[model samples]
Target: MVGAEESGRLVTVGRRFEVVRNRPLLTLAVGHMTVDMYAGLLPMMYPLLAGKFALDLKTVGMVALAYGAGSSLSQPLFGWLADRHGTRYIGLALSWTAITFALLGFVPNFAVLVALAALSGIGSGAYHPMGALNASAVISEARRNSAMSIYTTGGTLGIATGPLIGVLTLGAFGLHGTIFMLIPGLLIAVVLLFEMRAIALRPRRTGGSPRLVPPPVPIGPISVVVGVMMLRAWSVFGLQAFIPIWYASMGYEPSFYGLLATTLVLANVIGAIGAGHLADRFGRRILIVGSTILSVPALLLFAQFPGSIAFVTAAAIGLLAASTTPLLLVTAQQLMVGRAGMASGLVLGLGFVMGAIGVPILGAVGDAHGIQNAMRLLALIAAASASVAAFLPSEELVRQFANRNSNALPAASLPTASS
Candidate 1:
């Protein structure tokens, strides 16, 4: 039988664990779904909006960049908010942000539309870190990677499905006709936001407890992980930006492109789960580096062959490229100890910015040079970023930190080493 003192310690630790993540994982999952669904609406609107404004490729790229900017720029503020008030407020804010974007589709002017697009992006910025915080609160060290992989796949699916939505809406509504379609998504968001209220009044358990979490992992290793994500994002965003054009030019029907995209997204769903499990058994750093290295060849090969082979290669590239996402994030979180929000934001905010910037750069390149050149450059990013992942230390930094902390190691001695 356990002694009282040991039992008390267990209770304290259990309670702290409870408070950190007493909320349902489903809640976090639903939150991810709601926020990401906003991205699904973008591609559907892009063609219609471009025709309406008589915009060129560059202008349209700028419009896409505007949304990315909102998603990027708002990270620090949301990260800080998550750090302070907990993620519920951030989640609530993001939900409303989605609602605004839904309505923003109704506005007419191009400039106003851009502004609303940015605002909508800002709202979306909250979903990731906020959802991550909630997930981390509940996820123990063992299952975090898998849970995150599952959650992130939602975003990939939304992005993949967006073009279909846009096409269908165009067929039905004729450009602006789909503006009203956003209302239902907005209403869904409002309903989900209500769940936050219960999560808030639940109770706090982390206060005044003996520190049981491990030592902080090194920022350098985490930075390396973030760098890998930047490259992955670049490749994903670049292809996503131009693939529809490429497919059309290849003499494929829109339906064929749609089917190809759906296959790629499905590959992502499988890749994320498989990668998470791989990260668990082998190591995060190894999986990240390996995925990166393999993806480069896959992407380059795909670029060289732009028809059926490219479709097959794109799925292979996507699987390897996206597999690293959760591992990178999990590495960052371990590095930060209790600070899931900031660690997550650092990668996501920075990577998304890099990816967003890549859109305009590649757009201009596609205009000036050609789409092939744009794709080639993105493949380079995949290679370079993956090479960097080799340097990140993986071996359960959380355990490393917690082990060191238990020993009451000197502050100067505990330098957040990941190995």
Candidate 2:
């Protein structure tokens, strides 16, 4: 949609930039709300399902693991597809996600449930690339940090809301019925795919000859940034998985723990936006280093106590932890140049998969030692990620990306044809 209009002497780019930037935000909000709606209540589901199936904690955790596994596996493929085929491929993926996740609700058998969970994860795998690519399209080189922050916040909001929706739906419709909540949200995301399809590929139409084939993946500072992100994901996931249990063990009531989870997410939302703005104005390294340093004290303090102070500390932890995700995402996007889809997958997929692995490992340590003892490593890892981030060649990386690709705004950064 980023058409340039020619006067007798001057050429003006149309509002395509705004449309590209804003549309994805709208779509991502819908996508994440549905995903968050599911996430918010995911914890509450395990015990109920375990009872219905007569399963143990280990087995139930596997179900969650399988979901993560599904999400992790398809990332490389979807990322590849998204890059080669452009954002249009997300249409197939969105519809597939809605249908699979909705149908997953109908399966009662344990084995079937496992399979469905994997399928749902696959669907989720599709959503991330499109959202990341869309955000990348709208963000100018200068404002990518800000754009990613806003885009990633939608996800935080979704994650924040999911458990609440599950809990509320639990009382209203029971565990089986909560799937109804997710169905509409998935459908909405599927519908939004049409809008994206209607918007032609921006890179192709920017008065430059379109390269149908994406170039080989760049390997340098981009690789370094992604590795650091993967390491940090381990700690983030470990904390997200076990914090509530730790809080409950410390004598916090279930309802309060629930509220605390939501608070952490809410704080994360604030952190994401703030970090993005900060990254835009200051620079990525400063945001990453500052956020990580703040998180260490917050996580340690929360682990140290129980009650309002602990919850407050946990909220601070979330603020620091969640804020880093968007910064990481945008940085990866900037580094990868033409591989926006692949870059998103590498950052999010690998980081999250590492997080999935971290949960059980942390659980094992908590089982043999203690939860608090195990979490010290999490603090250390966060420190490392931040330290590693400070050294990443961000300015040089952006320059490298610009050296490789067309010097025009991507579809994510442009307005629609109608505009």
Best by lDDT: 1
- Candidates' lDDT values, in order? 0.67, 0.66
User: What local lDDT does model 1 show for residue 19?
Assistant: 26
List the candidate 1 regions with Cα displacement exceeding 4 Å: 1-23, 103-107, 180-184, 198-217, 249-253, 396-419
lDDT tens per residue, model 1, 103-215: 65567778988887788788778777766666655556566776677667766666666566656665676755546545545665565556665443122345575534435
lDDT of 1 at 225: 70
lDDT of 2: 0.66
Question: In every candidate, how many clashes are there?
Answer: 9, 18
CA shift at 43, candidate 1, in angstroms? 3.0
Candidate 2 TM-score, C-alpha based: 0.83
